[model samples]
Target: MTLEASVVHGDWEYQPVRLPRDVTRLNATAELGLRSRFGGWELARTLLYADGTRKVWLRRKLSRMREGAAV
Candidate 1:
């Protein structure tokens, strides 16, 4: 899996590296850039907003019940 990201700022080209797997964590720098440093976020959000993205993990059903469990 390969990740790709690109951005444009006042005719300046910006390309950032993305990991090829699901991110287990987001550092401060990554969070900051995503929140305010990049312009492509709006475009990316728009694209994703229209097309539903899948959640990484969700168990379908429970096989056995533990004590004091609801399900």
Candidate 2:
């Protein structure tokens, strides 16, 4: 998978998350938020990594939440 990021504001750029070939992209934002917070970053580089990581995480969380509700 390829990761792409866009320059947003003040030396900070938003990274678009790309999942690896074998990984699945979750469709939940809550999960992403939980995971993002869990990942925890204290530096610019770490934050960059966390930002993308959160997307994937949230996607998955959302997917699961939907599934659970359906049942």
Best by lDDT: 2
* Model 2 CA lDDT for position 20: 38
Cα deviation of 7, candidate 1, in Å: 9.1
Task: Report lDDT per candidate.
Answer: 0.32, 0.38
Model 2: lDDT of residue 12: 34
Model 1: ten consecutive residues of lowest lDDT: 54-63
| lDDT over C-alpha atoms for residue 18 of model 1 | 38
lDDT per residue (tens digit) for residues 14-66 in model 1:
33333323433355236435634443322122111233321221112222342
Estimated TM-score for each candidate: 0.21, 0.24
Off by over 4 Å in 1: 1-10, 24-35, 38-71
lDDT (Cα, tens digit) per residue for candidate 2, span 1-71: 34454334433334445443344345333434554677431123322244344322112223444446646
Query: When superposed on Cα atoms, how far off is each prediction in RMSD?
Result: 19.0, 15.0
